[model samples]
Target: MDNKIRLFTGGTQPTSVGPFAVNEAEQVETRPGNRPSPRELHVTGTAEVSYPADRASVRLSVGNNKTTVNEVTSSVSRRLEYILQAVRQHGVREEDITVRKFLHRDQEVYHMNAEVTVTFSDFDQMEHACSVLLEKLDRSVSVGQPRFFHSAECLNRVRQSACVSAVENAQQKASRISQLLGQSLGAPTLVREDETREWRSHGEDDEEEDGGGGRRGQEAASTQVTPLPRIPSVTASSRVSVYFRMRDGNRKKY
Candidate 1:
């Protein structure tokens, strides 16, 4: 048997189709289920405020070397007791004084050391206490410079005020930018606080305290004592980023 091949042909060719026409309204309208994208503006603002220090801390150390630990310990304890008593007479509370460090190292001569800290809210009292310790205590006792800083309540209050000012600054910036674009600023879409910064500086009036009458005058008259240096003020700053919606005056809302 011989293999045979058969070919089949259609009677009419298919008609060529042209591109569909789009009306003006259909071209401009968005897809029925899709929502419009949001419009927003971002701006950053910063603010800072300074406050005087309300607290001061002083560190003192007592150390001695002797042939035996008992002798050194006894000597250090007696000196510390006298120092504490002198400090308390100037209004330092027992709770505000703390033993910060104690160390003992064995050697040919037994060495012992103890550190104490005193905190004060009143500068006059602090000055008086420091003067008494320096004039009356043994030379072995060392006094460190006082460190001044704002209290926790003061820091928190200043920080909050700075944040509020920063936000207001961001809003004003956004409003100006929106006006330039022939649009108005709507409600803020997002707000975030940025990293905060702080700085410290000695205030000008810090030296004036030494010249005034009080503990300063008494110390000046008797021993020609140098007035304690003025405490520095602390400045706190905050930054914030804000995103606000924009509304066009001529455009209708969706």
Candidate 2:
């Protein structure tokens, strides 16, 4: 048997641990390959929120035909003024009222038309104003059905809440899936909204249509021929795609 002994005479010596020897210079060097990306689980989440209409708009119009433009305009103006007064009396703001006029000549008779669009925050006041106009003007003026919708602020909040709900749903789904697959759920790697949609649902009362010219007397009590003043709801939905880190469930993390 032959035996050999080695002596080290250097500024720095290599340290031996277990089966490998490492020096100060080798410790500062990075490993050859970059770390691999973590395992990811992909999922889609969807959520929707429904909110009742907050405000409404109604359009009213008056028209008259006469031999002279002045006469036709006068008649239309009187009715238009009366409509404005009624709308104002119901506590509607001035900025909420929009008025438009049109005058045209057809052969011998001159026709003049005036339209009033009013936005109302209070549904009761809107109903009352429409009722007054219909009851007084009757066949002379046409009142359109009130179009109900959510306000800007309300819509923004609904959309944001829906998005947040979708993300939370994604996290829950990912957690359950990872648990079932014998893996651990980690932080979300990526999240993005993939799709969004908004729609109005009238439910059973969708049979209602844009009302025509006003009906006589007691008919105005119904208020634009709608059924029972049903409050329509606006529904907003959001879909998101999320990527979450997945780790081996059996492996202990350092």
Most accurate candidate by TM-score:
2
TM-score for candidate 1, residues paired by index: 0.50
Q: What is candidate 1's lDDT per residue for 1-254, written digit by digit as tens?
A: 11111111222212222221111111123577964444566677788887888889999888888898789889888888888888888888888999854656776687888888999989889888878888877588898888887889988877788878877888787777877878766676456665577777863334446545888767658896555557777787877766665566676422
- What's the CA error at residue 79 for candidate 1, in Å? 0.7
Tens digits of per-residue lDDT for model 2, 23-79: 222112345685433456667788999888888999999998999988888888899
lDDT scores of the candidates, listed in order: 0.71, 0.75
Off by over 4 Å in 1: 1-48, 100-108, 161-198, 202-230, 237-254
Model 1 lowest lDDT segment of ten = 1-10
**TM, every model:** 0.50, 0.55
Q: Report backbone clashes per prediction.
A: 0, 0
The RMSD (Cα, Å) of candidate 1 is 20.4
